[model samples]
Target chain A: MSEQYVEEGDRRREIIEAALRVFSERGFGGATIKEIAREAGIRSPALIYWYFKDKRALFQEVLGAKVPVVRAVADLARVMDLPPEEALTKLGRAYFAFERMDARVLRLVIGEAIRRPEVAEAFVRAGPGRVLEFLKRYLERQIELGRLRPHDVRSGARMFVGMLIPQLAGKLFFPAMVEDGLTDEEHLRNAVETFLRGLAPES
Target chain B: MSEQYVEEGDRRREIIEAALRVFSERGFGGATIKEIAREAGIRSPALIYWYFKDKRALFQEVLGAKVPVVRAVADLARVMDLPPEEALTKLGRAYFAFERMDARVLRLVIGEAIRRPEVAEAFVRAGPGRVLEFLKRYLERQIELGRLRPHDVRSGARMFVGMLIPQLAGKLFFPAMVEDGLTDEEHLRNAVETFLRGLAPES
Candidate 1:
């Protein structure tokens, strides 16, 4: 890439980081471009519009960028050929790790989504929606390979994703209830095991 | 019960309903007793204290009362003797029904739980904590009856609850992602079937 192009990309990344901080502190409705510009240390607040169209656009970019799992979901081809156990285990670990790392952003997205229909749509489109779609395709491939029993791959996708939701919810929204003797790894292993056994093909 | 005592109970219920509305609009930190009193049609804001100790108490009550599944979890005795398929199906239906009926309050508790640690603790203690504990006991009893395979009942309980989380989350946080061919009944059946098959006893 040319020097000027690289510099513009770096500047965009910086602005997104600043916007995430601002959005985390104040929700989507409360965050303003001026504050984001100040947070990014940009002298001209109007410069934000040079990169993004509006606050909604910036918010959408932030939602898509902050979640590391979105990138993982996009790169499913790397693990697509592995057995379901290994592939799912890797996915589960990455899923929980993202929850731990970007919990503040996750909370912000969830809280805003509840109040704003537009934000909710954007969040689902950017995050869980993509993850579920990836899983559905992965399950279909596994079934084709005779690794999984024939069933509704879509429901199977949701069920696998659902098996991981409680741990995330407990860790984020209810810390008191999480110390129920099992570590995250143990819990995840159980989830994957049950899912595989439940979908095992006939002998 | 005496007539006057019954009246006091009814008045307390009225106050809780009013508080739920206010809390749904504003959150835990944002809600105030005065506004709640106005919403409740109570002449004196101080009268709220007579039914509950303070705003925190009222908020807790609102969280507890708004979730119909909490009541269902407590009434598990009514379904304990049935097979796992029947009992778990009943539990899962009630769980989704509560999410539908009280999505607003669920959002309120979740949003506030992110902002306030106290609210988070109270929410888990009153809601998911009780539900998980009830499920754990029920699973343990099932194992004793030779119906389910002997395994870690605690993890089993969490796995069952986890299986239902995605649907609740999709309905509340992201409405667009839920209409994936299967109905709620179909999804819940998939979950229960997977869980029971995974935990089925050795022949």
Candidate 2:
């Protein structure tokens, strides 16, 4: 890439990083672009507009950068060839690991999402919505390959995701109650196995 | 009950109702007893002290009263004799129905729980923690009765709950994405079946 293009990319990354911090501290409705520009050390607040359309677009960009699920779904193509059990376990393990790492930011986004419908819409579109869409397509592909049973891939995708989220959420939000239960490995194993059994092709 | 006893009970309920309103608007940290008393139409803020020990205790009571899962688990004894599928279906159905009705308040508590650790603990203890504990006990009972396979009942309960929550959360937080997919009945059916199939006894 040209030097000018690379510099623009770097500036965009810096702006998004600053936006994440400001958004986490103040939430979607409460955060201001001028403050984000200040945090980013940009000389002019209006310069941010050169990169993003508006505050909402900047917020969306922040969520896209922060939520690992976005990257996971993007990378789903690499594991598309694996059988359902192996692929899902890989996906689930990676999802939980990244989620643990991103727990603080994720919690802040979720908190905001609950209070603000627009934030909730942005969050779902950038994170779970994309993941669910990718998962449903994967389920359909697997069923076509005769490795899985035909069913409502939307709900099937939901069921698999459903199996994973509550555990992560419980650990993040209620560490006291999580108290020495199944190890993460065991939990992932059980979750994957249970999901596979439920979706196993009929004889 | 005597007139004085009846009056005390009514006053306590009124205070809890008022506390819910204030907490919903201002969150756990922002809400104050004085505001709650005013909302409750009590001349003395100290009267809230007689009803609840403190703000945290009052927050706990609001969660307990608003979250249907709390009452569902409390009444688990009535369905304990039923088979696993039958019992779980009933419990899950009740949970979703109540959750839909209480979505606004539950969302408020969840939003606060992320920002405040104490609220997280109280929320879990008053809602999901008790529900998980009761479900774990119920799973153990079913396994002993040979209606379900024996395994880690803790994880078993988590898996079952894990299946239900994401669906509810998705619907609550992202109506745009849930549009015209599986109906609530279909989603619940798939979740319960998947969980049951995973835990079925070996032939």
Candidate 3:
């Protein structure tokens, strides 16, 4: 009986992995539960239903498990000891790459947001909300340590992250907007330098 | 007759205005040529075809004629005589309002961008592209006059605008993301404050 329970747990995890692959390929609207089940090699529709009440619930689970807002928090913590300029540059690059890699999932949330407000609100809370809060905490720490200039920590955090997104989103949505010579590294580096200069403590 | 030519011009202008209203309400995918004709008070579909090849061309024309990147350029000129703090504050608020009011038109352009690259490029050029270039010129002028600190004018323009977008877009897509007591005025005011302080010239 215990062995059967373990097998069921493995089956559930496999279904989630397969669902993510299907969703990424076909998008949430185009993907179906039976296709997800077939992708997972689970012949029984009942088994998939037993695991997730519906496709929406399964999609939400996949977003939470696969998308990595938490990875940003973890990555920032690793670089906390560096000076503000270096730490923020590293964090900004990580944030940029994170959003770039996860653009499809973000687009899914955005499309759903157009149809219903609840899904958008949930995504903000689960995704950008977490990253914003984490950056605020880091800024507050820097201010407390006198390593960074003091300002409205919340506004500062928002501005810092906001500086990184326009070019990032532009590149994703309008690939042609990126000039011939500019690169992601150069863009993030310039934004970080300008931001840090702007944030410099009053002389 | 000359009267017939004059009437044709008047009808074309009227059709463009009505199409703008219809497109804003229904988006590109949802707006139909028949409905546009109805909105424009024209019974003949051939009239719209005379002025536009299809809905896409009509949509592009409306975007170009109605959405005003030049408005931002013109607004900045009106505010140039003011002190840095006041000018930036007013300019930020105006930009904030511009994007807020034109959100629907911008969304239509973004939706089309997914299927074709040309539309996105045009938008970037007509919309944010023009605004960013205008800003870069203003910042360069300030730097030369020593009114603002010298920085990479491109980066400066980007950071300044980046500081303004989160709240504008949040109010559209995720109303709940906005915090209590952060009114539009307050949001713009706070962002302007943070941005200017970051750009303050060393005394």
C-alpha lDDT score of every prediction, in listed order? 0.81, 0.79, 0.69
Question: Candidate 3's residue-wise lDDT over B1-203, tens digit each?
Answer: 34245587788888888888887787666678899999987778777898899877776667556655445455666755667677667666666664543666666556565444676676566566666776778787777778777777767777777776666667766665566335667766667766666666767
TM-scores (chain A) of the candidates? 0.86, 0.87, 0.72
Give candidate 3's whole-model lDDT.
Answer: 0.69
Q: Candidate 1, residues A40-114: lDDT per residue as tens digits?
A: 888777889999998878877776676766767778789888899998988888777764437887787787887
Please provide, for model 2 over B73-180, each residue's C-alpha lDDT reduced to its tens digit, 9 standing for 90 to 100. Answer: 777779788887788888788677765436777777788887688878877777788888889999999899988888888778888887776677867776756864
Q: Which residue pairs clash within candidate 3?
A: A198-B198
What TM-score would you give candidate 1 relative to the actual structure? 0.87
For candidate 2, list the clashing residue pairs, or say none: none
Worst 10-residue lDDT window for candidate 3 chain A reads: A174-183
- Spell out the clash pairs found in candidate 1: none
lDDT of 2 at B201: 89
Which segments of model 3 are wrong by more than 4 Å?
A1-16, A25-38, A43-70, A74-82, A98-101, B1-13, B29-38, B43-70, B74-84, B98-101
Worst 10-residue lDDT window, candidate 1 chain B: B1-10
Q: What does candidate 1's lDDT look like per residue over B115-155, in tens digits?
A: 67888887787788888888889999999999998887767
The better candidate by TM-score, 2 or 3, is: 2
For model 2, what is the error of residue B110's alpha carbon versus the real structure, in angstroms, after optimal superposition?
A: 1.2
